[model samples]
Target: MKVGVKDLWAGGILIFLALLGLFINGGLLGIGLESHALGTARRMGPGYMPMLVFWLQLGLGCLVVFNAFSNGPDPLERWTKLDLTTLAISVSSGVILWRVMEAIGLNNNYIQVGAPCFVAMAVLAISPAWRPLGLVLASFAIFGLLLEPLGLILALVGLCVVSALADRDHNPVSVIGMTVSLCIICWFVFIYELDIRVPLWPTIF
Candidate 1:
């Protein structure tokens, strides 16, 4: 008994995504550059949130490329080997979160609603296996915890944890090394320069 190659289409998509991510994250999104102060917060326009998002997306894309490449994708096949369970969970969770958004008044309190969505997305990325899923969820929970109520430190710690989990081995030394490096880089762009108002924890409204 053996596995024929997975669909060539998926493999090609994976590779194409990698290249797209690499270029966008490294250059287009300006990951390594500095940004000007946002200037205003009330009357109209240019919010810290958008800059925060740009940085996050840049980071995601870069990390995605790393993930796609490190997996050493299998050869392409005509037939597709779909992971329907994972896809189903992700899509369902996303749609449900969006629907619940209006009920929860997420439009007004974006942070509260967004925190759970972030956690769900991360958790669903893993299969239903508890050991792995629990670990991932725990990290995300800590992130949301820190990102609410107060300061930047806890969120930073959570960020470090989540970033480390992205790797397969979760080797402590390497994870720590990578985490610290990414944190410093992010801090330089988002904190020192852009000065985005990231909550350490969310205050209840």
Candidate 2:
């Protein structure tokens, strides 16, 4: 079977990622994870996630190569240049927001700084018809900002509401129900089951 350029390109990228992951996990050149650091599976060490990711990448790359050989060649889609203006605006806005947050002594979390900029860029760059992305970004930004101050439940609810706005055919009742249910489940799983350290409610509330 004839191989397509698209398949080859994808396969090459996957293979490169797989090798890079492996290199990082294998501690080659004395720069990657050390053997001693990779503890048992039950008590996962620093290298566990990297090893898992690399192995998955390797497997996917192999599958892509096999599919390329098994399938016949097809027409490649035309590649379009990325909108540099959108990228520039998004990056600059994110940087500015981060700096402002730092100056204001708001928690310097990366998500809190980046989310608003992402929403702004999405709203400005994309067609107005697809405003849901902007809504989602805004929701995420709000969630990030409120997560610590308002606590998880309130922040998550706010996230759900704003993100639900992205769907043109959204049902408010369903969105609220789902958001509440998800927040409860997340609170239970992350806080109780996983024993994660996060505030359930604000100190003032």
Candidate 3:
């Protein structure tokens, strides 16, 4: 009845994330759900789905921990110096660049472009095997960073391109189709139908 180290670590992380989400959802630390109500299941408040998800995650994490004790001997993988360096440098570069730009009151296109570039390059340089993870992280970060300066359409396009690049088997036609479909759907649902205030083009335009 030995504990599987890998499963133990995985389950611990899942439990931690679930607890963090529950704390936020329940307003335990005054982080989130401040104004949102926790209405009944039938009524379905804004916090209802997230609370349910966190509970499910907690249950799944507990099950995984239980299984870890019952499962065979699987050890945890050690993070190399390069792995830690890659993560630290990549994340810090983007966040530091963003903070510097915001502090200087220069929320320009350069900050939006530079941050993700730094992240992608650092990840690729240090750990080429983690290309998909790096690409996905950079893509989402780019989308968030560029949403204000470059607008929704360009941000979505950037997201699609970078994310598609993550998959080695991704086709150009499929990427194009997905990009177009996403743009149209977002435009219709978020801007037109929902009347949300969002920019459609570059701020310069």
User: TM-scores, in order shown?
Assistant: 0.48, 0.54, 0.60
Q: Rate the local accuracy (lDDT) of all candidates.
A: 0.55, 0.70, 0.77
> How do the residues 92-201 of candidate 2 rate in per-residue lDDT, one tens digit apiece?
77677767777777665666565556556454445343355566777767877678878899989988987887886999999989998989898887787765566788
Q: Which wins on TM-score, candidate 1 or candidate 2?
A: 2
- Count of steric clashes across candidates, in order: 9, 1, 0
Off by over 4 Å in 1: 1-82, 128-145, 148-150, 181-205
Candidate 3 global Cα RMSD: 5.7
Q: What is the model-wide C-alpha lDDT for candidate 2? A: 0.70
Q: How many backbone clashes does candidate 3 have?
A: 0
Looking at candidate 1, what is the lDDT of residue 42? 34
Once all C-alphas are superposed, what RMSD does model 1 give against the true structure?
Answer: 8.7
Global Cα lDDT for candidate 1:
0.55
Ranking by TM-score: 3, 2, 1
Instruction: Give the top-scoring candidate (lDDT).
Output: 3
